[model samples]
Target chain A: MASSEEFNLDEYILHHLTDSQEWHLPFLPTIHLPEWLSLHGVMLLLSSFFLTLLFGILYKKEQRVPKGLTNLLESFIIFVRDDISIKYLGKEDGRKMAPLFCNFFFFILMLNIMGLIPLFSTATSNINITAGLAIITLTFMIFGAIYKNGIKGFFKAFIPSGVPAPVLILLIPIEIAGLFIKAFALTIRLFANMLAGHIVIISLLGLIIIIGKVALPAIFLAVGIYILEVLVAFLQAYIFTLLSAMFIGQMLHPDH
Target chain B: MTAATFATIGAGLVTVGAGIGIGLIAGRAMDGISRQPEATNKIQTAMIIAAALIEGVAFFCAVICFMALGK
Candidate 1:
């Protein structure tokens, strides 16, 4: 982008879309590492570390009638546990999965909020990151299904009970496919929402460059969008966590 | 018109449809809440879920439109 003399929208958008920087192992000469490190991945690791360290320090300061930042953070934790995890995942399983739900909610919330900040890239905006999160969710769902039902019972999920012999053949494949579809939906939902929000913001700003004379109105519109993007950041994080819990709940106690 | 123009038009068409679908969901949800203010939370929750589902479909269309741009 910097190399080109004339500004191109395609290059501008593509530049913003791509990971700008990455890090790789320098010491391991013999070991092969894939294109593993990226801006989003680094941000993810930073947020994870921040969450852990913050929570670790906060854990020691716990008191009755929680106060200050601790109170606010605790409320968030309780909300995720009760509203998201327990509400969807059920009392028994939800209680067991509360820690995980809190982690998912906080981790995503951190990443989404960070993305809004100037100069920081959105980790969740990356499909790979969101897909990784969705896969973790799917793994939880699968394990929950197996734990609730035996191995045979788990496979039996693909075929609904009391179905016609011929219908079973068609139903089984569809049901199995549905399992992956759910995860894919989860991945796309988060990734697309995050990505679209940024794209919209960048495009709005680009309007100023495209129409140089009407910069004032375009700037105003872009500012409005920036605020909405802040709200969307939180909303998307919450939605992702809530849907993951619901998917896990459905698997834990299959209604069909 | 070039493929890019068509892709832009297609995306606009998709947005038109999605806007109506989401608007319908939101309008009904608002009506329901107005009729029964006590059930506002429930209505809002249902509205969000429906809107998200509709938005998901719109996003799928958007992905197709994006692919069309490349071709």
Candidate 2:
């Protein structure tokens, strides 16, 4: 039997906050597995696989006038392509990136919504996962810059043309840092939004224990927060995808 | 006051500041849209982007508060 002394609110909260399981490398046990390979790894893998399977099914069973999940998925894909990718990245590049952007948006949406399910953790809530996603966007940005302007021209565009030598020197580092900061901000934005919602919901529910018998109100409040979190899940996914497209667009046309 | 107390206050201020920032952003966006009704879509898109950026900074401070509490 468990002892009463083992019951600690802080520990309980901390346990709730942390990932349920983790694993390290076989040879180097001290080094934790990368985010994509940890327990959140399963969630990530499932989300990606589910997205692929959904798309494949939708494609194979193309309707004369789409219905059900096919119709819903088509709208989301078209929205991402039109409002997010094309609006930010323009028609030429946007068309090229439409599939990738849709993948990111749906994958993240799946992960965020999964948090609402009992016993499932949010993969995007982890900084490591968000950072890994941001790194993918960063790679796209760099590739876009190189593709648009050529390697030599890409570096040259950073100086902003016709600046004093001293100002140019100062501007160079800032521009480079700005590129990374955009990705860093993206990582933090998605991670914080997801993590904060879970924390708030948990904390609100925890208040029932803290308040000691005034539990009725607390449960209602927690329910309210849970509903709000469902909305946040969709909103954050959309925001992250939109911002990624915007950042990549900036890199593609730095002169603008 | 303890460091955690100070962190709590700091975190509260961060939330307050972000709330104001987002409010101002939405208020201005509404004003812009009202003035130029045709630009409602543009204003709303810009507003959402701005609010997300501000919320990101607030979350950074909230994380700091968590670190303090954990300590």
Candidate 3:
């Protein structure tokens, strides 16, 4: 880390945004971790740890009527079951997939909220993590469709039934591309949203370092964005979970 | 112009496209809410989903433009 007098805005912002094996604190020694242990990996592990602890603590409370944390968590699960999965997916199947949807929502929500903490980096901001999650959704989409309608039906899905023969060639390619693009878009959506939020916060904070005391008012703007980031964290998690369920539901009930 | 210049312009253009889409969604959602008043929850959910999908494409292009700047 450089002294404030020799501050570099680009390097500072990029440093805070990108993942690395080393953790650097301003005016402190840089702590280097093992090659396999990266910063984003650490954040991911921390979030997962917290998630498990939360669920573990809640698992034992056997009140017939849910209250406190149990009540709140139950409400969120019900929302996912009723509003997301059940709304897009059928009743039986949506209930079956509720646990998976719950996992996706809370895991992502944990990562997003944890990232806002001062010492933590955002794992979702990494393209690889988001891509991995998107790939799971894509796999479920393709496989769910296959399971529902068999292998022939999956292929038949690309070609609308009773369509003219010549149009098949053009339509098939477009349909296939559409499937992949949707998955790709899912990947970018989470990654870009988290990354962009962090970038804006860091950039605004950096103004104080790059410039002088004249930039003090920028802190309030940064705080304003920070509050918005809190909302976005929840929103992005909900959107990701909702869209994933929607994609799988579309495959299960393909009209065209 | 250099690649960075084009990259910046491309990112700006992506914002323009997505901005209009989200604006339209917001406007219609507002209109629908005002007209029906009872369907606000459904309308708001639909609006967010549609806006998020459109923003996904915008961010995809923006990510490419950003990578170009690194080149």
Model 3 chain A weakest lDDT span, ten residues long: A22-31
Give the Å error, residue B37, model 2: 2.7
**How would you order the candidates by lDDT, starting with the best?**
3, 2, 1
How high is the TM-score of chain B in model 3? 0.98
The residue-level lDDT of candidate 1 at A94 comes to 92
Q: What TM-score fits each model?
A: 0.88, 0.89, 0.95
lDDT of candidates 1 onward, in order: 0.81, 0.83, 0.90
Q: How well is each residue in A64-138 modelled by candidate 1, as lDDT tens digits?
A: 888887888988889899888888878988999999888888898999888887656788888888889899999
Give the candidates in order of TM-score, highest first: 3, 2, 1
Better of 1 and 2 by lDDT: 2
Q: What is the interface RMSD of each candidate, in Å?
A: 1.1, 0.8, 0.5
Stretches of candidate 3 exceeding 4 Å from the true structure? A4-6, A24-30, A59-61
Candidate 3, TM-score vs. the true structure? 0.95
Best by DockQ: 3
Supply candidate 3's per-residue lDDT for A205.
81
Listed in order, the DockQ scores are: 0.57, 0.81, 0.91
Q: Which residue pairs in candidate 3 have backbone atoms (N, alpha carbon, C) closer than 3 angstroms, thus clashing?
A: none
lDDT for residue A220 in candidate 2, whole number 0-100: 88
Off by over 4 Å in 2: A1-6, A22-37, A58-61
Categorize the docking of model 2: high
